[model samples]
Target: MALFTNIARIQDGLLLCSDSDEEADYTKYQNYAKQLFQKLEAMEQKIDKFSIEESEFTYHYYIANGVCYLGFFKKNYPYRAVFAYLKELEEEFRRIYNQQEIEEANRSFTFIKFESVIRNLRQKYTDDSSLADKNIQQLSENLTDVQRIITKNIKEVLERGEKLETLNLASSKLSNESKVYAIKARNFKWRMWWKTYSPLIIIAAIVFLVLFIKFFIW
Candidate 1:
């Protein structure tokens, strides 16, 4: 059975930190949500909806009115229900709070009151009987396959960090190798110059010594 783990509201990439009783780690989920928000921001065109899949949970996010509503659900959770929940949350949030208040709030979980709202919604959506509910059934019917849309595996996400670390290490090693090669080439050039010119230098010294002795003796 898929569970509703968490919900959040983000604006302009900043999470409106709110107090929550949900079992999922808020800090970790917040970081994941921020990464998703950044990906959306990077796109030239705005995307109103997207999903990211992690090992334990899949995230469904909705963007509206400059605020992002993010939800964490079990992998098999119905995405349509998840989205409908987000939409309801978004609408309710907008109804209760103005844009200026949402934007100006700097404290974490500033909207702690919403936690109860989420709990209530989660119960309604997660219940088996809710599947037969007209609203949920309609939502499920209207939506496309959640698995097919913009899904990212948790392993791939972790591997990306590992790959970046590997690239940095490789780059540092290559830079050090180049520096060592340059120093060796300079030393080799000096040694070759010494070998090529030593005899000529010795001959010149001998010739000068002979010229001095002859001038003095004569």
Candidate 2:
């Protein structure tokens, strides 16, 4: 039989169990119980969605390029998986945002991803009615808005770039045409000048020839 088999009593909210032996083995059992409790708490947290009041959300912005847009982040948010996804987007569009011009865009994408994942997780938690599910509904909605804005802006920028290219090509063609027309006009002027001088020289030569012939006959 254990040395302290029945001596252990309930202290606070923990089971104070002791071993019925010369050296008590409470340490082992206590450690095991603590581990189990931790696991249970973690499980519970997963099932319940944490509420985030809208009033706490002061960082939300809409971004658009032309056709569609996405959200931007203001502060770093906790959520590893979601933040990783957002980091990818930021890296992809870093050049478009003029990295140095607005540091906010980078931050915004991160927050949006974090919020989106949390919202999905919350929905899942709600379905099961778990206390661990921390549903960030407000953040999720904001992320959606940001995505819309970013998509629109990106599309617009692409369209605008295409248009600029088209206009550049057309202008180049016009410039070439003008040069060709100028060359043709110069050639026509040269021909007209030669024609105008040749007649006068011919008339002078004819008059000189008649005078020379009359002088010889006399």
Candidate 3:
């Protein structure tokens, strides 16, 4: 929750600062930054949805695809990699939160995680300093692709974040409308039932009167 809040604050702050500033680069950077935070916010929402909070101290987050449980991480997992991936997932989530987004990120976060894994691989390569140029080239190419995506999608993602905000509002309105309609329908049904059964009740009374007259008057 705090994580989500922090991301939201950062997102809002970047937007506010961007609005106040006059510099183009700074504005663009702020836009990207806001987009980044929006992505994080979206990721938090997804985690909350598919996740089951295991009491106040822990939570089990299910991955979107395969519905695989990520296991219960204690309230605060210290692995930077985990947080980073979550953060990246949020980024991806912001870009696409629809079914398409969810499906894509189900696979996309793998690449995001792969970014870290490849970084570790590169480090290992440097440590021994004996890895071939071919492997290096492959890793470099993959990394380039990842960066290109992040760069291009920051704006695309910010747009998605905006859509999420709109969606939330629309969802709230639709829910309220449904509730009101339900109440009206229930009231209408109650009235109709009364109207239909009231005649039967009157007929029963008239039949009872006729039976009493036949027995007593004759």
Whole-structure CA lDDT of model 2:
0.28
Work out the TM-score per prediction: 0.55, 0.19, 0.23
- lDDT by residue (tens digit), candidate 1, 116-145: 776775564455323335543454454342
Clashing pairs in 3: 39-90
lDDT against true structure, model 3: 0.33
Number of colliding residue pairs in model 2: 50
Instruction: Using TM-score, give the best candidate's number.
Output: 1
Candidate 1: which pairs clash?
17-108, 17-109, 18-109, 19-109
Q: Which of 2 and 3 is ahead in lDDT?
A: 3
Q: Which 10 successive residues of model 3 have the least lDDT summed?
A: 14-23
Number of the top-ranking candidate, with lDDT as the measure: 1
lDDT tens string, model 3, 1-218?
11211122221222210011122223343334444443434443433222222223222222333222122233432222222333334444344334443334322133232233333422332332122334323333432211110112334435555433222111223223324433433455566678889999899999999999999987
User: Distance from true position, residue 79, model 1, in Å?
Assistant: 2.2
Which window of ten consecutive residues has the lowest lDDT sum in model 1? 163-172
- Candidate 2 lDDT over residue span 105-162, tens digit each: 3221232323334334333323322221232332333332121111222223334442
For each candidate, how many residue pairs have backbone atoms clashing (under 3 Å)? 4, 50, 1
